[model samples]
Target chain A: DAGVTQSPTHLIKTRGQHVTLRCSPISGHKSVSWYQQVLGQGPQFIFQYYEKEERGRGNFPDRFSARQFPNYSSELNVNALLLGDSALYLCASSSATKLFFGSGTQLSVL
Target chain B: QKEVEQDPGPLSVPEGAIVSLNCTYSNSAFQYFMWYRQYSRKGPELLMYTYSSGNKEDGRFTAQVDKSSKYISLFIRDSQPSDSATYLCAMMSAGGTSYGKLTFGQGTILTVHP
Candidate 1:
């Protein structure tokens, strides 16, 4: 069975632009979460959705948003991107509380 | 202070050597401790997880949690070249609004030479 899959394996955008990254959770999973990992740093929590409802959010700014669909697929959108926004964006899915992550999308904001 | 702290090591070890990675957190409420491994330019893969304070062992990997010290560790026995990667420690605690949320450490990069 497929674990988790993310879209646009890589992405690039300019400051003030917007980018959306997609992810498909493991089949039958109900929880999907997003994380951002900058160069030389660990993944930082962004948001988590369960049953298509926002379950939790991290300390990220309002420019970062996400939504989960009925099928447990997820999208992470970042607006007004800054140079600092360039990082590896990861999506993780879970059947319970333990997370299974995808290969992730490498985002570069110039 | 940050909730979790980890040493970012460019630690080099020979194949078949034992490897130990560690993290410490200030939050006493954290109940779940997890270790994740990330390859270059990839997402983290869960390696070890332990709930509360205790030890959990999987094939060749052992995780230890000490609530008294607010510390957690992951040890790999008979490390292989394939075991080279960044090891991250994550913790989960109640945020007053959610049941589970994770805080991650900086991660340590390990290189095992064959």
Candidate 2:
């Protein structure tokens, strides 16, 4: 079976641009969470969504938002991206048990 | 200080050597602890997990938590080149502000030479 999958494995954008990263959870998983991992740092929580609704969010700026679809897929959107936004965007699937993660979407803001 | 603290070691060791990684936390509320391994250009993958205190072992990996001291550790035996990666410690609490929310430590980079 397929594990968590994320789209646009790599993307490059200019500062002030917007970016949307997609994630398809493991076939039957219901919850999806997002994390940002900058170079030389651990992954930081961004948002968590379940049943198409946001269950929790991290301390990220309002510019970072996310939504889960009825099909259990999810998307992370970042508006007015800054150079600091350069990081790996990870998507993890959960179900109150443990989390299984995707390979991650590497985003680079110039 | 950050809720969780870890040594970002570019720790290098020969194959078959033992490896030890650790992290300490400031949030006493954190009860569930975990270790994740991340390879280059990939998401972090769960390596081991523990609750509150004590130890848990799986094959070549061992996870230990000391809630009383707010400290945790992960150990690997017979390490190989494939073991090279970044190790991250994460934790969450059962209630309060950190409930169901994990705070992470700066990851440690490990290299197991073949």
Candidate 2 stretches with Cα past 4 Å from truth are B95-100
> Per-prediction DockQ scores?
0.65, 0.59
lDDT of 1 at B74: 92
Candidate 1, superposed: residue stretches over 4 Å from native: B94-100
Candidate no. 1 TM-score: 0.96
Per-candidate TM-scores read: 0.96, 0.95
Give the least accurate 10-residue stretch of model 1 chain B, judged by summed lDDT: B93-102
Specify the highest-TM-score model's number. 1
How well does model 2 score by local distance difference test? 0.89
lDDT for position A66 in model 1: 93
The residue-by-residue lDDT of candidate 2 on A10-81, one tens digit each, is 999999999999999988888888999898998889988888878789989999999999999999999999
Q: How does model 1 score on DockQ?
A: 0.65
True contacts kept of each: 0.59, 0.57
